[model samples]
Target: MDSSDLAYDVFSRQCSSRSTLEHVTGRWGALTLGALHDGTFRFNELRRRVDGVSEKMLSQTLHALERDGLVLRDAQPTNPPRVDYQLTALGREIAERLLALIHFVEGRQGEVLKAQERYDAARGGL
Candidate 1:
């Protein structure tokens, strides 16, 4: 099918975009993309910036993003071999949107916590 003729409906279970959406919105995926938004980062740097991601999870997330064409992995031929990750054009577009969402949630965290407290109290939780 032609590119324009392809239909992507994320809500549909059979839609390929659903998988891409999951990767883009997954915990590690979002965090990874957000970190790479500033510039390129080596694996260790990404781990430090992402705070809680395990090495395995980080590696998997990077691989997934690279497969999705949202991340570029550049490996330099050296004695020890160095690799860096950066967001592709498509990745930057999605990362910017994700960052906005993260900012919004962060800004309203206090309010969300208060609402959660109220909800829990109503449900008989401490």
Candidate 2:
């Protein structure tokens, strides 16, 4: 295809903006990336750290990250197999961005709470 044709064809389709946002800002993905920021973690450790993630969801999310080449999964041979997960370079970059987002939320938490309260009061009165 010509360069302009390729550009037009690529731009013709709707981008997966919703899924992309969901992947980055999803509850599990956000928590997982934040946890991995510290260092590598085993499956159980990750499960514990992420608070509300179910075993199945954790597994599925990890699989997605691994498939995207953002997570490095190292499986060790043992009586029971041991798997450790660490962020790939790309993952690390994104994790840093996530960290910044977390910080932003934390800093504005009080303001956000006040805004929510105002909204609730207004809506409830209406």
The global C-alpha lDDT for each of the candidates, from Candidate 1 onward, is 0.96, 0.84
All candidates: TM-score: 0.96, 0.83
Query: lDDT tens digits, residues 1-126, model 1?
Result: 796699789999999899899999999999999999999999999999999999999999999999999999999999799999999999999999999999999999999999999999999996
Distance from true location, Cα of 57 in model 2, Å? 0.7
Error of 1 at 54 (Å): 0.7
Which candidate has the highest lDDT of all?
1
- Give RMSD to native, each candidate: 1.0, 3.8
TM-score (C-alpha) between model 1 and the true structure: 0.96
Give the C-alpha lDDT of model 2.
0.84
Ten-residue region with minimum lDDT total, candidate 2: 3-12
